[model samples]
Target: MFVWLTQFILFRLAFGMALLLSTDLLASKQLALNSQTADFPVVSYCVDPDWLPYEAIRNNQHVGMSFDYMTYIGVLAEINFSLIKTESWSETLDKLKNGECQVASMLNRSPEREKYLLFTRPFFVGANVLVSNVDQPFLQGYENIGEQVLGTVANYRQAEYIKNYYPNIKLKLVDTELAGLKSLASGDIDLFVGSLLSINAQIQKSGFSNLRIAGIAEPQDILGMGVANGDQVLLKKLDTAIAQLPEWVHVDIYKQWNNVRVIDEIDPRYIFGGIGVFICLIIIGIWWQLIIRRYNGKLVAKNSQLQALQNELVEKNRRLEFMSMRDPLTSMFNRHFMQDRVEQEKQVSLRTNVPLCLILIDIDYFKAVNDQHGHVVGDLVLQEIATIVCSTIRDMDVAARWGGEEFIVLCPNSNLDDAIKLANRLKDAVSGFDFNTVGHLTCSFGVAQHYAKESFVEWFDRADKALYTAKDTGRNTIIAAK
Candidate 1:
């Protein structure tokens, strides 16, 4: 019974091509034995007119790989089918399912639509690939794509696939594939994920030389055509027609659409750059050997002096960079950086009418800890405490070491109550954390909400006063400013 039920479902899911084969066309050998049983020979098919290489109407003429294949099938079956063009893929699918259109060309098959339609044996197999602007360097692959923002068609399989695994990649879903392509060309997105064939064709038509393929997506089931689910007779007919097609049909289709060349790997600049660097290294090595062989005491001393100066310069640059907006020892944003960030947050909150809150945290009995543990251990504790605070804050929230043992957290769009609750959570998280060799630690925090007329510094002073109150009244507690 299970086998019979499966067979019944499979048959109903296929096309109605069997009805066409059994007509008078079959008596004349024009139609196959598995052709559809329809009379009067009325056939209707749906195609996405804007999709290139696969299906598109250009200059009042419809020509595409799928269109040609369907035409070949029509000629063999002696069926006169009316071509129905739709602007969107979803609309075309709707036409097919509603019986307004009997065939849909070039659709991917997946579980989402399996219950509603039958898929043909795949006519062509291709991959979704990354496309980038011509001036930009090609991405290494999806693995190295975190820094880039990608654009793609909404509801396309590539977008869904990326969202499933590459959650860190920034994705902007456009209305259509062409919109995604245009966004890539306009620099709206660093990369666009689309079909290799279709994107290449669109690029050629638009005369876009700067756009190129970055990488290809893994082929999967989401790429195929859809037919009404109850069309078992049609499925057998289409399957028979597909099996009988010339082996060269696939090759011909590919050749007809092969205009865009996909770059399967990285650009030559890096490759050439690496070779140049290696040659330089070899030359330097030979020079170093010669200098060693002809060693003069004075020149050797000069070389050592020059090396020391170069090291000093490098160290100076490193220190300068480290000190820019950061406390070097704790690796937290310095007071200057915190002030600028808070000012920006205040302006944004004023303009958008959004709530903003600030939390001032101080290490409880920090001076006592320094006296007992030595300044070196106190420095370690500060570093450990900074790490704890940074880890506990949300990505959108900003945490900075305001100065010395005090740190500030800027929470945007958070109200007074939410800020108080979050302050308590952070206090708890810090208290519960085991700081390894540092042993038990606690912090006192002052939380304050922003008022519309208050300046960034004004709001911070309120939070700061609360911190002093927490320290005075007793440590290890959170106080909210009135």
Candidate 2:
């Protein structure tokens, strides 16, 4: 019995390791593929006409979270997308089914749809909510959805899930959320079932002041990108692109659509399992005390081995965390890390009445460095500049590579004047540095101070415009945005 228990525990441990290893391998594959150009130059996708906040077509242009997500994917994969416009939400599905378009973004998985559509792994998740007239009592679940008609956009997977799981709920198919909300407000339906964020946006925009959230209903769907039937090539391509993205990429996109921030998740099942294992081991130790003469040395050796394994796992996790937050070439913090720090510092500044400042730095005529001296020398110049900025900044300040030829510095307790001074210091540092073979390099600087009630993006944009002003006037200079 003891031997079997030991084998079972070992098997669980090995299974956990295999899961982590497989995940790492998948991410590595995504990285490998994302760094290269995709087989297709362009891929077209069908767009829903009025699925606001997640996707919509406005004035012939695709807009919202899914559009932003796929745009990033296209940029990384070196592919282009032409969003094929459809007349209605139902039409969007038909376009993909009939192969009128090759891709559809944020498509929920369904067994019926799977027959004609290939789906990538779910890249985002959101819950289905019931929106109803403000007079309606808050609904807790779909099971309570009795004889009253439940309004929903036609062909929505949310509606489909309801049909499959709770067939008794009367469904009223509508072309859009606007119509559904109108119908509900007029006593034509009990509730409208859709994405919580989307329903809220529609209510606010269309003057559905009479409508309110009846309650959040569940079976939160995992959303994925879908391609035409048997389009494994495109499906795999999208999956790889999504896998290659950092967690912050998804966070940024979600932030644009929803006011709420997504919290990092922990697997409670594993957590509880770990606690159970600890308790089991304690009981085993009590048993072992009776057989100390036979088991003391074996237990000690086993515990030592376990301690070593724990240390090794911790070290590996530390290295991975560091690597994820930094730019490999420059050895500087990357935008992901910078964004997180800015958010933290911004909240602190707001709470304490302390000033926060941002500086945007851009390489002046950097393309010339790559064009004339080759990318190797260009990279070296970037590395050298990163080192200078790292050395010049105060220990309390944070710096990060924002993007190609651009960097940012965050000053936690500094005002506009202080930020300008720091920018000038960094500007001087870069200008004075000897590039060995590449010669001297200069950078343009932009400074901006945060203001009450302004968003993080707004603050960043102000500084970015300042950087542009410096570039327009000349290369090596500073500009402060008002």
Candidate 3:
């Protein structure tokens, strides 16, 4: 009986999958018919002549995963792809830009490329990795490559990203992934970046025993065929073809190129034995169900009580977590939370080469306010100042009550000038506000931009010294750390 049930389940699954495939094929056929009616011309395509496993040109023929995918897509769309070979990837880009080729066989989409090409849906996705000499330490990611000379393929998206976002790092451009790896092996470049697939393929093909994967890169690769700008009809057809391609076809092509073994069939004897075991388990489950039913009511009541207790504990834990991170008086983030956030922001600043700034603001004459007006009024003054600080700073800035009568604001992506301007605005807001019973109060600010490779303790010390200067020069003024 279990054997029969297993067979019935497999039949149903196969039938559903068949119906889905039939629907996809019918849609693909309609697209083909449309292309036939339109008389879509043969597409002249270009490819990186050296990139392998993903794509390459050899013996005057297109090859690799992109070639296989395009071959299948061309048949489904009733179109043809004619190879327009180039000697290098740079030449391929020129061909696409010059209209020598109507399609780029595979590439990542970028704003610069978008000017000359219309991209189809991504047909291949893979993570990128950092490659370095085997003696190098394992880096966490691209963000940790401080001061290292990084090499990337010229005109590749990774090079573009590093230039645009991480300009502080020295960049060395190579003509190909193989060249980059060779450069690293010879100690000419400190690191190289490329997609995991092509990187592995090149390392293995070139027998580069000295190179190792140092770390994962920032963004994963999203590759698709690029149609030349103004080729809307070809773009639409390619998109449809890619979307309709069967999942198994993609799996098969990937496995073939990656040298992964494919099992064609499962053993019938194992299937029968598995079904017999399942039947035995079902019989035991039915017997167990009868015993469980005898105590079902009692178990249900106990479960309800346990659920109520669990809910209460979860609520209590949430409140505890909130209390731990927040100041009770001002309801602002406490020092502990700010410490963690500052560390995270500093790492981001280092990684992206973006500027970060810190502003240390101290309420002036706070001890006098408490001594003169009592702690209740002092508490209200703190709350009112917190409100002003929140209102004065941009939403991206994080403000925390840094112990009694002091606060800290962490400004990400802000330079020294911008941070000082923000600090002045905050100081003005505090001095102008009426505290009711306390009348008017003022705040002194010390603003400092984070220096590259500076420790958190050193960064904070600079800001603190500037605050002392502000207090000495006269309270309620802003002083920027030099």
All models: lDDT? 0.68, 0.74, 0.78
- Candidate 3 residue-wise lDDT, 114-212, digit = tens: 788877767776667788786667676677898889999999999988888898989999999988999999999899998877777665555565666
Stretches of candidate 2 above 4 Å error? 1-40, 134-137, 259-482
Each model's total of backbone clashes: 25, 0, 0
Give the per-residue lDDT of model 2 (tens digit) for 1-482. 23322432353353334433545643443344433434437788887778878888898777788876775576445566767888887788878888989988777767678778876656776656777675566576787767878988778877777788888888888887788888988989877887766766665455454565666566555677888967766766786778675575587777667643222355598689668766766889766455654555775675565445444433433344345467988989888667756765675576458899998999999999999989998888888888899999996688999988999999978999998899889988889888878888899999999998788899999999988999999879999999
Shift of residue 387 alpha carbon in model 1, Å: 61
> In candidate 3, which residue pairs get closer than 3 Å at backbone N, Cα or C atoms, i.e. clash?
none
TM-scores for every predicted model: 0.44, 0.46, 0.49
- What local lDDT does model 3 show for residue 54? 90
lDDT string for model 1 (113-225, tens) is: 45567765555655456777764454545787778788977656666667777889898998777788888888888888877657656665454556666655543322334
Given candidate 3, what's the lDDT at residue 165? 83
**Residue 320 of candidate 3: its Cα lDDT?**
42
Model 2, residue 452: displacement in angstroms? 57
Candidate 1 local Cα displacement, residue 367, angstroms: 70
Model 3 spans > 4 angstroms off: 1-40, 260-482
